[model samples]
Target: MDLEGLKLETERLLLRPVRGDDFESWAAFCADPETMHFLGGVQPRAIAWRAFLSTVGAWHVQGFSFFSVFERATGDWVGRVGPWQPEGWPGTEVGYSLARHAWGKGYATEAAATCIDWAVDTLGWTDIIQTIDPANTGSQAVARRLGASLRGPGRLPPPYENQPTQIWGQTREQWQVNRLRLRR
Candidate 1:
């Protein structure tokens, strides 16, 4: 996939490719315990920047990477969302998080919906998994809002540290049905 200028625009958020310089703002969000609860734990700024750059670089190499989400009205960085392949998972996963301040505003759902649309419409991906920490009821709610069905337990790497994850899923058939209904 030629991903020169890939961007996904939602009603209240602008989803764009993460650049190297987004370190400071992105790190601030990641550095928080609440925001990073499902994403391992808080990390040093340097580690956070490196992780962000890894996502940026993955965009070129894997044709997809975690996107930086910003509020369109205020132009403030909120969090990240996108498709990823966890170490042992067989299919691609739709992963996301939002700053504590940006919570309850539907930014995560809005951005995640756009990514789901792209996966089904543009990328021809049939099945997408959303792995949420069992304790993260907020994220689980977001997954449900996107029409993803619970698929059972999913495992992840350290930091996650063997926490049991609930896998929510959306198939192409389900997405297509929902998309048509959305259009109507």
Candidate 2:
């Protein structure tokens, strides 16, 4: 897990480590009420900066975090998606968030599926989860598209401990079977 050299590409996206230059788009995403609705509400610019920095710090401390996602054709910062497991997290997770404008294009699924594969194959994770707010139909759709099944209610760690979520996921064995079937 050489964090600096890490990068994952899908047909329409480039997922890589968060960089200083990404703050603008990151802040914009954080400020959007719709985009941040399930992600702790709209954050002020200053707060968003702290959140952005935390993602950068996670890569240094944990060797993995949400990778900043970019549109391949336009080189626009679209969002962040990938492996994440903070202290007290429910499980090893692959999460995604995209700017509002990037929505409806299946970018989350594309980026998340790649991250899930890496977690299972490269990181040797036995299982992975996505803690999604139940009202977030879009994310639930992405989870379903990835072959994850709802495992019932979940809770976030402190600060966000009260927020209700649903755990959706699959075991590595299950993902492998799905992958093989997908290729068929």
lDDT of each: 0.81, 0.91
Instruction: For candidate 1, write residues 48-128 as lDDT tens digits.
Output: 877887898888887787888889999898888888874566477878888899999888878887887887777778898
Which residue runs of candidate 1 sit more than 4 Å off their true CA positions? 1-4, 157-161, 180-184
Lowest lDDT 10-mer window, candidate 1? 175-184
Candidate 2: tens digits of C-alpha lDDT, residues 1-184? 6777888998889999998999999999999999999999999999999988989999889888899999999999999998999899999999999999999998888898888888898889999999999999999999988889999999899999889899999999999987665445
Q: After superposition, how far is residue 33 of candidate 1 from its true place, in Å?
A: 1.2
Give RMSD to native, each candidate: 1.9, 1.2
TM-score of each: 0.91, 0.95
Q: Pull out the clashing pairs in model 2.
A: none
